[model samples]
Target: MKKILLVCSAGMSTSMLVKKMQETAVKEGKDYEIEALALSEAESKIDDVNVILLGPQVRFQKPQVEKVAGGRVPVDVIDMQQYGMMDGESVLKHAESLME
Candidate 1:
């Protein structure tokens, strides 16, 4: 299964988003291993994921994460509107596009 990592300040809110994204993926018959983590833990976990999505609150950390990713994994921020709405499908679509 492909892996998607979502990171935020403390990983709490992103956990809810992860559950929603997983539900959407299953409904679409796609099997993906999605997870949420605190930015502090993201660096240790970055190498294992295909893409990294930063929560709007933590979007400023993008360059740091990208540095750790070393061009191997795509890094982006979840759209502020979509993230505020917890729109999993849209975020998943964005992640899918990045993975492709």
Candidate 2:
């Protein structure tokens, strides 16, 4: 299963997104291990993830996350509009594209 990590200021907001993504993944017959974590927890979890998606609220931390990830995993920010709308399919697609 592909591992996707969603990071935000406190990990709380992304939890809802995680659920939506999982629902979409199931509906689309995609296999994935998705989870959310606070920015503070990213370093410890980076090694185990295939892709890192930053919540828009934490987009400023992208460079720091990338640095910590050391180019080992792809890091990108979720589109603001999609994120705000909680469009799981689009976010999942974004993750899928990054995995490519």
Candidate 3:
């Protein structure tokens, strides 16, 4: 199973996207572990994740997160439009592609 982590300013804001992503995964028969966390809590959670996706609001922190990730995981910023629209399928596909 792949562990995909989404990070935003407050963590709370990504819950809906997480839900949508989870639903998409289930429908596609993917057993991925999807989750979201506040930027403040991301570092601690990064260790176990296979990929880390940043919310548009927190995209600027990608460098910092990558530093913490230290090449152990792939980190990327979600597309602003996709995030704004809460398009979970796109984001989930993006995450999977990164893992691949």
Candidate 4:
């Protein structure tokens, strides 16, 4: 299974997105382990995740996250519009694209 981690300022806001992404993954028959974490927790969690997605609010921290990720996993920022709309399908698609 693919392990997808979503990071935000406090990990609270992205929890909703995680839920939606989980639902979308199930509906699409995609086997993925989706979770949310605070940016501060990302460094420790990076080794275990297949991809790291940052919430728009934390987009500025991409460089820090990527450094922790160390190119072992793909890192991408969630689009502000899609995130605000809670568009799980698009977000999931974006993640999937990154994995590719």
- lDDT for 74 in candidate 3 is 99
| Candidate 2, 1-100: lDDT as tens digits | 8999999999999999999999999999999999999999888999999999999999999999999999999999999999999999999999999999
Tens-digit lDDT track of model 4 for 1-100 = 9999999999999999999999999998999999999988878988898899999999999998888788999999999999999988899999999999
Candidate 1 or 3, higher TM-score? 1
- How do all the candidates rank in terms of lDDT, highest first? 2, 1, 3, 4
Candidate 2 lDDT score relative to the true structure: 0.95
Q: Extract clashing residue pairs from model 3.
A: none
- Runs of candidate 2 with Cα error greater than 4 angstroms are none
lDDT (Cα atoms) of all candidates against the true structure: 0.95, 0.95, 0.94, 0.93
- Candidate 4 clash pair list: none
Off by over 4 Å in 3: none
- Tens digit per residue, CA lDDT, model 1, 1-100: 8999999999999998999999999999999999999999899988899999999999888998899999999999999999999999999999999999
Model 1 stretches astray by more than 4 angstroms? none
How many steric overlaps are in each model, in order?
0, 0, 0, 0
For candidate 2, the per-residue lDDT at 7 reads 98
Model 2 misses residue 100 by how many Å?
Answer: 0.7
